[model samples]
Target: MSTRNPGSLIARIGASLIVLGSASAFADEVVKIGHAAPLTGANAEWGKDTENGARLAVEEINAKGLVIGGQKVTLELDAQDDASDPRQGTQIAQKLVDDKVVAVVGHMNSGTTIPASKIYSDAGIVEISPSATNPIYTQQGFKTAYRVVATDAQQGPALADYAKKTLGAKSVAIVDDATAYGQGLANEFEKQAKVLGLTVLSHDATNDKAVDFRSILTKVKGEHPDIIMYGGMDATGGPFAKQARQLAIGARVLGGDGLCADSLAKLAGEAADNVVCSIAGMPLEKMPDGPAFEQRYEARFHQHVQLNAPFAYDAVYIIVDAMKRARSVKAADILASMPGADFVGVLGRTQFDAHGDLKQGAISLYDYKGGKQTLLTVVKM
Candidate 1:
């Protein structure tokens, strides 16, 4: 004992203390939330906006601090860029699963959401899409799939009804990017448009990545349709509208939520004036919590909120609400609690039906005037 080296004993004590600290820190649980969107492509603005909404929720939750299963929990967002590609969406979903994310907040487009949804379902991870509206996304019987927005089923009919009854369009020409979201919306719109007695002059197909729509516009122009409906995202929809205006086509351009963004005005320029679109949720100014949320969002993001940001924000709270209800941060527990979620969020009461679709959903129609998005009407569905 007298010959014991003091330096060695001090080093051993220091190592022991480090191990204890590490273990103490590890006691705090980290709940990883996954977000997949096109953060690097033409849809980057929307993707980043969605990510920011989730981030805001995560920050707020962490600030308040969550206690799950008697342990301090920290929420972490694992944001991934799917680039609006279905192939990349699945890859991102798998990566999130491998990383052990407890839940997912996205796969923004229906095309990406549909393919990636299977992966999340297989992994038993609950995924709530803030923006994917294709009816097929939830009809597939994936218990893990959920959405905060109205589907194309409701949105399409609303747009079609408006076009037929309000806009008094006797004939419509449809152009789709041929994506799951685009085609699904176009089909639904055509179905309802037909029922409303509007003639389907021509239904054309264009890829999502296509920029030159002169050919499509030329064909559409030849039809002399009263309204030109495009089933695609703002990235393509905006350019298509601009080209239509450049070609001097007088038909009013119409689209769904994919084209209902604040940035569309800038993207479509003067053409945006004739652009009429529909979104899956009520206008922010109309939502009970919308104005306050907008102010908070602008302060945090240093920019205006986009079409789906509020939905994304509500989705994060929905996940956290599930965690709180289940009293655990485990994925299985969250999934178990998700079905009965009745949390009142910025978008109002968030309750899911058996199909994982919002029980009370609404579609808002919009148009651009003086380079600003103006809500035309709110149609509850």
Candidate 2:
């Protein structure tokens, strides 16, 4: 009992040294991923939801004992608040680059994503948008830019098609927020609506920040159209619907992804019932792993997902998949491996084409009923 076995003592020391060495390696190797969204203002809930998704993914990845290039890698999320402003998005992009983030997962709106894409391009980092639906985001030929959702080119027509065929809208009034997303979606909707023989009464503009749209609503109400399509986010679209009702404009309201939110009803009060919107993805219930993911999300965040959280979650996993395929965490290597990736996550198949657009896109139509978003149908494009 007094004598300690020499072999046992040596083995114990070796094990202790190995544990310390691994801990040191793990502490030294950290990979940063950037997320940018409107974490303040009316859209803050959306931003927070997306950030939580990225946070959950990072936490899980780190727990898996991630290793790249023989080093134990700890993933970190560098979330920045862009406030849905274009200029601020670019600034955040540069800041993330300065911080040496390997890849980025947001900048929610097209107005923000487009300007920030150049910054990420110059920095040689990959940027994937979870919610930006403007076609120009991918059409710009930026290899570094990608989006998980469908673009306005697809989403606009789907919404317009629904208005024409389902709602049988003979004439429609178009109102846009004047932002890149709003303008682009409105343009596509207008173009398709005309093709379908739907009379386009007027196309008006509004600022995203403006709450009082009486001026525009009054002008639009005069037209007496069958529907009023507001190309904007829930923040503006909600009030737009409410004001339209207030002005006694009985036309139904329609819009693209920007207006598809659970909070739209609360924002517009009872007026949300007249709103029909399209999101450039399948319904969460339709997503392959959506149920389990939703359970995990609520358990971790202690709140219902607002929007785009699933896409953001998948975006994080996509970046990690690329890193694993390349067997390196370097941005260049990860990006090099991304072009051919076929990662499957909560969103099903996450693949991109040469233009960095989704290989297959879908549009899910929804309508507000009794203060909740009710899914109508999902159209694949």
lDDT of 1 by residue, 1-381 (tens): 499999999999999999999899768688899999889988899999999989998998899988886889999999999999999999999999999999999989999999999999999999999999999999999999999999999988899999988999999999999999999999999999999999999899999999899998998888899999999999899999999999999999999999998889888999999999999998888888999989989999899998788899999999999998999889999999999899898999999999999999999998999988888999999
What is the alpha-carbon lDDT for the whole of candidate 1? 0.93
TM for candidate 1 is 0.95
Off by over 4 Å in 2: 1-28
**Residue 37 lDDT in model 2?**
94
How many clashes show up in model 2? 0
In order, how many clashes per candidate? 0, 0
Model number with the top lDDT: 1
Estimate the overall C-alpha local distance difference test score of candidate 2.
Answer: 0.91
Residue pairs in clash, model 1: none
